[model samples]
Target chain A: DVKVTQSSRYLVKRTGEKVFLECVQDMDHENMFWYRQDPGLGLRLIYFSYDVKMKEKGDIPEGYSVSREKKERFSLILESASTNQTSMYLCASRRQGPEQYFGPGTRLTVT
Target chain B: DQQVKQNSPSLSVQEGRISILNCDYTNSMFDYFLWYKKYPAEGPTFLISISSIKDKNEDGRFTVFLNKSAKHLSLHIVPSQPGDSAVYFCAANIIQTGANNLFFGTGTRLTVIP
Candidate 1:
């Protein structure tokens, strides 16, 4: 079974505070992705990693960054949290196919 | 620019009735289409998918229909159950030789009243 897990189910942060979201997948997949889900905007990709220590920006990657030091772990960092950054953050991992398995997701509230 | 669109914000249907969700895409290069179901506070799960080469695919109660000429697709759920209530999202992918990326629509909230 493909199992993906996240660090937190819910979090709260103040403005300018740095926030980190962690994700780990049990399967040794080659691709990982980060996305933010808003009410009207749906799920927009933030960044993706094809391999360890390799990363690429997605459609909405302006205020966020990602780290993939190991094949099993992927991290998303928010440089400075803002109210606009409050949303549901989802982590996904995919093999060489079209199906991407996702974690439970973290709901971040920036105040 | 929104490549994919789900115009309906919400839909309500009664139990045992068929629920139809629609989606449209602007880019003709998208050859693969997918639909996902997401409950509150949980990540979306893969529901079903169809390739551009085919017009329809069905899995039990879930079926997906695609129209290449109209650049549109729809998901039909027969005898909708209360447990099926959730947000549905439509996605399309650009199939490359060894790489693929998905573009998503806004989503439609489906309420199945018992």
Candidate 2:
């Protein structure tokens, strides 16, 4: 079974604060993704990394950045968090196959 | 623009009844479609999938029917149980694109009352 773990299950941050969400996968999948889910918006891709240090912007990449310095870890960074950035964050990892294993998700509340 | 759409935001059914969830896609390049189930506070989980070449796929109580001509698909859960209640999201990907990204729908929340 593949395991994807996130650094935090819930986080509360103040406005204009820097925030980081970390994800790690044990499967060594080359493909990793970050997504935010909001009511009536579904899962919108924020960023994705296909390989180490390789990143691509998804549909909604604004106000967010990603880092993939190692194979197993992927981090999502919010340079300066805002109230609008509060939402559930999900991390997923996939190999060459179509199936993507996902972490439990982190619910971030920016006050 | 949302390439995949689930117009229904929510559905309710009695326990032991059949639950049908529908999804529509506007992109012709998508060759594979998948359904994911998500619970509150948890990430979405892979539920079922179907290839464009095949019109139907079934596993246990879950069956997925695809209509290529209409660019639509449906998921049917038989004898729906309370545990099956969750948010169902339909996702699609283009195999030819070789990109691992998948287009997702807004999702429909299913509720099964015992």
Candidate 3:
């Protein structure tokens, strides 16, 4: 079985604070993704990394950045948290295919 | 401008009944489709998938039917259980520059009554 783990299951941050969400996969997948899910807006991609040090902006990448220094870990950074940034963040990984495995999401709340 | 759409926001079914979730896409370039189930506070998990070449795919009690001409697809769950209650999302595979990414629907919340 494939396991994808997220650093935090729940988090709360004040406005203008920096936040980090980490994800790690044991499958050594080549592609990793970050997405924020909202009530009426499904899972919108924030960023994705295809290889170490290589990143691409998804549909909604504003105010967010990602790091993939190693193949097994991917981190999402909120430069300065805001109320609008509060959402359910999800991380996924796949090995050069369309089938993706997801980790338990991190529910982030910004006050 | 939403490429993928799930017209129904929610559905309710009784246990031992069939539950059908529908999805539509505007992009004709999509060749692969998938269904995912998500519970509150959890990430979406892959349920089943179908390719454009095939019209139907089934796994255990879950089955997916695709209509290429209409660019639509549906997932049917037989003998629905209360544990099946969750948000179901439909996604399509889009290839961009040799990379395949999934474009997802807004999702339909399914509730099963015991």
Candidate 4:
């Protein structure tokens, strides 16, 4: 079975504070992705990494950045968190297939 | 632009009946479709999938039916149990876009009453 784990299941941060969400996968998948899910808006892609040093911006990458220094780890960074950035963050990893295994997700609340 | 759409926000079904969840897509480039079930406070889990070449795919109690002409697909769970209740999301895999990102719908929350 494939397992993906996140650093935190719930987080609280103040406005303008820097926040980091970490994701780790044990399947050695090449594709990793970060998505923010909101009610009525669905899950929107924030960023995706195809390799350890390769990354691409997704549809909603405005207030976020990503780091993929290693294959098993993918981290999402919020340079300066805002109240609007509060959302459920999900990390997924896949290997040359359509099926993506996702982590438990981190619910970030920016106050 | 919401390429994948699940118009229904929720569905209710009896424990022994069949639960049908629908999904529609506007992009013709989508060649692969998948269904994912998500529980509260957890990430979406893969349920079943069907490629454009096939019209139907079945996995135990879950069956996926696809209509290429209408660009639509539906997932049916037979003998629905309480454990089957969850938010089901439909996702599409776009081809030739140089990216393998799967576009997802808003999701439909299914409630299976005992």
Candidate 5:
């Protein structure tokens, strides 16, 4: 079984603060993704890393950045947390196909 | 533009009945589709998948049916249990350029009453 673990299951931050969400996968998958899920908006991709040090912007990447210094870890960074950024964040990893394993999401609250 | 769409926002079914969740896609380039189940406070988990070449794929009590001509797919779960209540999402993928990104639907919340 593949295991994808997120650093924090719940987090709270004040406005204008910096926030980080971490994800690690034991499968050593080459593809890792960060997504924010909101009601009626669906799971919109924020950023994705196909390989170490390589990142690409997804549909909604504004105010967000990603780091993939190692193959097993991926991190999502918020430059300045805002109230609009409060939502459930998900991390996923896949080998080379559509079947992706996901970690238990982190619910971030930006007050 | 929303490439993947799930028209129904929610559905309710009684225990031991069949539950059908539908999904549609506007992108004809997508060659693969998958279904995922998500509970509150948890990430979506892979349920089942079907390739464009095949019309149907089944695993245990879950089955996915795809209609390439209509660019649509459906997931059917028999003997629905109360524990199966969750949001179901449909995703489509195309690997033509080596970038395997999935386009997902808004998701349908299914509730099974005992």
Candidate 6:
């Protein structure tokens, strides 16, 4: 089975603090993605990596960055968490197909 | 702007009835469509998908119908049980890109009363 796991199910951070969200996929997929789900806004992409050491910015990449040192793992870094950045973060991986498998998602609250 | 849109924010249906969820897209280049189901605090799961070449696709109780001319699509869940209650999201992508990128619409929350 293709399993995607996230580092945290819930997190609390103060303003201006750096936060890191980790995602690991067991299926050795080539593409990984980061997205934030907000009410009314839906799921907006933040970043995606096609391969190790290669990344591309998605529609909403501001205030966020991603790293893919290994094919099985992807990390999303928030330079400085803000109150407006509080939301559920989702990670996904796909293998040369239109369907992308997603992680359970991390719900972050910035105060 | 959102390329894909789910105008309905929520829908309620009784058990053993058909639940139809609608979605629309403004882009004509999208060649593939998919539907995902997400529960609270969990990731969205792939439910069904359809290619542009076909007008309809079905799997068991789930069926997806596409209207290319209207740039619209619908998902029909027959005999929807309470277990089907969740958020349903419809997504689209251009198969030619091969980038695994998808444009998702604002999801519609489904509530099935048993």
- Scored on chain A only, each candidate's TM-score is 0.99, 0.99, 0.99, 0.99, 0.98, 0.98
Global lDDT of model 4: 0.95
Candidate scoring better on lDDT of 3 and 6: 6
Clashing pairs in 2: none
What is the per-residue lDDT of model 2 for residues B1-114, given as tens digits with 9 covering 90 to 100? Answer: 999999999999999999999999999899999999999999999999999999999999999999999999999999899999999999999987797898999999999999
> In candidate 1, residue B28 scores what lDDT?
92
Candidate 6's TM-score:
0.99
What does DockQ come to for candidate 1? 0.79
* Docking quality (DockQ) for each candidate: 0.79, 0.83, 0.76, 0.79, 0.80, 0.87
* Candidate closest to the true structure, highest DockQ: 6
**Which ranges of candidate 4 are over 4 A from the true structure?**
B95-98
TM-score of chain B of 6: 0.98
lDDT by residue for model 6 over A1-111, one digit each (tens)? 899999999999999999999999999899999999999888999999999999999999999988999999999999999999999999999998899999999999999
User: What TM-score, to 2 decimals, does candidate 5 have?
Assistant: 0.98
Q: What's the TM-score of every candidate structure?
A: 0.98, 0.99, 0.98, 0.98, 0.98, 0.99
For A1-111, candidate 5 gives per-residue lDDT tens digits of 999999999999999999999999999899999999999888999999999999999999999999999999999999999999999999999997779889999999999
Between prediction 4 and prediction 6, which has the larger DockQ? 6
Candidate 5 ranges beyond 4 A from true positions:
none
- Which of the predicted structures, 2 or 5, would earn the higher lDDT when compared with the native? 2
User: How much is the lDDT of residue B9 in candidate 2?
Assistant: 99
Steric collisions counted per model: 0, 0, 0, 0, 0, 0
Residues A1-111, model 4: lDDT tens digits: 999999999999999999999999999999999999999888999999999989999999998999999999999999999999999999999998888999999999999
lDDT of 2 at B96: 76
Instruction: Report the lDDT tens digits of candidate 2 across residue range A1-111.
Output: 999999999999999999999999999899999999999999999999999999999999999999999999999999999999999999999999777888999999999
Give the Cα-based TM-score of candidate 4 against the true structure: 0.98
Task: At residue B36, give the lDDT of candidate 2.
Answer: 97
List where candidate 6 sits over 4 angstroms from the true fold: none
